[model samples]
Target: MNYRLLIQYDGTRYYGWQRQNSTDATIQGKIEVVLSRLEGRPVEIHGAGRTDAGVHALGQVANVHLTERPAEEIRNYLNRYLPEDIGIIEVKQVSERFHSRLNASEKVYVYRLATDPALHVFERKYMTPCEEPLDLGAMKEAAAYLVGEHDFQSFCTKKMKKSSVRKLEEIRLEQLLGEIRITYRGNGFLYNMVRILTGTLLEVGIGKLSPEDIPAILEAKERQKAGATAPAQGLCLKEVRY
Candidate 1:
């Protein structure tokens, strides 16, 4: 049977979602270890997205094939073995052909920024701290330019070999009590796309980049033209939509 899983993890310790030869301390590797033990054989699991190291996820999705087992038991069994930082939120049977990555229709990522000078010890792992005040209006204007479908080469990493053209369904910015939350909803995102976008928007918000310059920046398609990439800790995979 094909089972779909909803996962949540604090990626601070893991070496990203994909298994790595360098380190067995990965989200996928850890889960596969438990699954392999449970099935008494190799059990391959597929995730909806490969979140970068230090990035968190609240609603990550994955799928795996397993011999008939109670979904609730599987969830509880995995939780017993999986580390405290990683969890399986939900599990259910799915069509044999359903693939987590290929079947995803949309994804939402949010970046959190702490604008205060005094850092919260607990939030240090989840938010990026910015001491400077940001111009929210300017950031909003710059975000509007990025709403439609465009070649996001400027916002993507230069190492990306795939097509940079992607549809950005929405970019919402909200400030609450000194914490700035930037939400991105899109069909898909290139490598480090959200972090770069947040960095560029921060530049605009802090008077370093003009909101009017966004159009020209998009047209340039040069990675150097964009701002620095924000830290990975600030990014979170909020949800994956099918």
Candidate 2:
């Protein structure tokens, strides 16, 4: 049977979503290890996307195939066996044709920036603190240029196997409590695209870059011209929809 899982995790405790040979652990590697132990065999799990270290996800999706267990019982098995930081929220039988990555229609990511003077140390692990007040007006104006299809080469790192051009469905900024939230909805994202975009918009909010300059940066198609990549701690995978 093939099963789909909705997972929530604190990425600060792991290297990232994908497995690697390094000493640092990863979310997928840990889950695969536990599942492998239970099934008395190896198992491969696929996630909707790869999140960076120190990031968090409220709605990460993954899929696995197994022959020994029923689909519903796999959730219980994972819950009982997996560590507390990672939890399988839901599990369902998916069509054999369904693939987490290929069938994905849209993805949403949110980047948080804390603007309060009174920093919460506990929350710092989950959010990026920017003591400098951000101008929401400027941020919104800059974000306006991000919506629609364009070549996001300047926003991403690494040369992609596919084209850098992508369709951005929505981009907006919202203030919640002491934090500034930047939400982006798109068909897909390139490596570090959202983080780089967030940092550039923050610069615009702080008077370092003007909204007018965004078009020119896009024209340049150079990664260095964009804003610095923000730390991964403030990034979260909000949702993946098919």
TM-score of each: 0.96, 0.95
lDDT digits (tens) for residues 1-242 of candidate 1: 99999999999998899999899989999999999999999888999999988999999999999999899989999999999999999999999999999999999999999887365667888999987989999999999999999998988776567788999999999988768999999999988889999999999999999999999999999888998999999999999999
lDDT of 1: 0.93
Highest-scoring model, lDDT: 1
Question: What is the TM-score of candidate 1?
Answer: 0.96
For residue 172, model 1's alpha carbon misses the true position, in angstroms, by: 0.5
User: lDDT for each of the candidates?
Assistant: 0.93, 0.88
* Model 2 vs. true fold: TM: 0.95
Q: Model 1: residues >4 Å from true position, as ranges?
A: 117-119
Deviation in angstroms for 65 in model 2?
A: 1.0
lDDT of 2 by residue, 1-242 (tens): 77888999999878889988884389999889988887889888999999987789999999888774676688888889888999888988889888888899999999888787266567787788898877889888888888899999999889767899999999978888788888999999999999999999989989999998999999888999999999999999999999
